[model samples]
Target chain A: EAGVTQSPRYAVLQEGQAVSFWCDPISGHDTLYWYQQPRDQGPQLLVYFRDEAVIDNSQLPSDRFSAVRPKGTNSTLKIQSAKQGDTATYLCASRGQGSNERLFFGHGTKLSVL
Target chain B: GDQVKQSPSALSLQEGTNSALRCNFSIATTTVQWFLQNPRGSLMNLFYLVPGTKENGRLKSTFNSKESYSTLHIRDAQLEDSGTYFCAAERASSFSKLVFGQGTSLSVVP
Candidate 1:
């Protein structure tokens, strides 16, 4: 089966610029998650969705970061005003509905804010 | 304080050798998942556990819910096994949400 797909494998932006990352989850997967992984660190959850509804986004930076999964299949995460601290890899993952399902991740978009 | 902490932040091993990585959780976790982030930055699921042990080829993992720790063992390490290993835990109160460790970077040299 094809795994999760993400566009723009890399992104470079200046401070205060805007950028968006897209993710296409695996078919039939019910859960989608967006994570931020800084260099030398593990992935940190930014937001997640079950279908079209957001399940959790408490860790998301409400001021500049926003995410949406309109059709419940594809998702987009946007950064209104990027900061240097935003320099990290943006990873997208999906999981099935099984009780003990494993997560599948995309190649990830490496973002650099200078 | 970190909710999940991984030991041996970085390790270098010779091919054909064996090494083990560990993760300790501060929260009450019910399930654990291990992943390897390759050089190209792809998170590959290696094992998912619930208080027991699972083995795949030369890799083995065990999770102890009572002690709130998990371990990943790599045997006969290969160059292809070089990557960053991460262990994430699902809290008892949070079903799908996972808290990740800082990760252990492993490099296998031939």
Candidate 2:
């Protein structure tokens, strides 16, 4: 019954640098999500996947942000050429297929782009 | 415009007091979920609702899909209750996509 796990608790990089955040979702969960939370704000959806296929990513900054859940188990979100506005917490969450299943979140990776 | 709006952007409550947070959805939503983001930056699931009421310990939540709104009530608040509370909604036209409110910052002090 392990919860969603995200790696690299924190990351600091200069503008234009690249960084990647990883997430290992709970076992048996089929849906995974990535969210961005700015300081003092609620999380905003960046992307999500149902198994290995992306469900939606319209809110993502396609030019710089890319996400992959290749095997449908673990996921990675990458930011290319990070900007100061990218300084926020990246959160990973997972949910089961059941209609009533609740979403579980990870501790999140706090990113600071200077 | 915010699809999900939370009232009283910030609040302060003395320990043992009671308070409530609310979210009003401008979109057609089928379900609602509430979460507590602690100071350390961990998001904890508080309640998930589908047009009904539920209670856990000193907390209670009610979601009225017909009115497109949800509420979270905290009773006998403790210091541990200090954090930001967020409410998310699942649109009736879209499944598995959750839109979150700006959040209500709650500070419970002794």
lDDT of 1 by residue, A25-57 (tens): 999998999999999888999999999999999
Among residues 3 or more apart in sequence or in different chains, the pairs in candidate 2 whose N, CA or C atoms overlap within 3 Å are none
Q: Model 1's CAPRI class?
A: high
Error of 2 at B45 (Å): 0.3
Q: Could you list the CA RMSD of all candidates, in the order they appear?
A: 1.0, 0.8
The best candidate in terms of TM-score: 2
lDDT of 2 at A37: 95
Worst 10 residues of 1 chain B by lDDT: B90-99
Flag clash pairs in model 1. Answer: none
User: What tens-digit string does per-residue lDDT give for candidate 2 at A18-106?
Assistant: 99999999999999999999998889999999999999999999999999999999999999999999999999999989779788999
The numbered model that scores best in lDDT is 2
Residue A46 deviation, candidate 2, in Å?
A: 0.5
The DockQ-based CAPRI class assigned to model 2 is: high
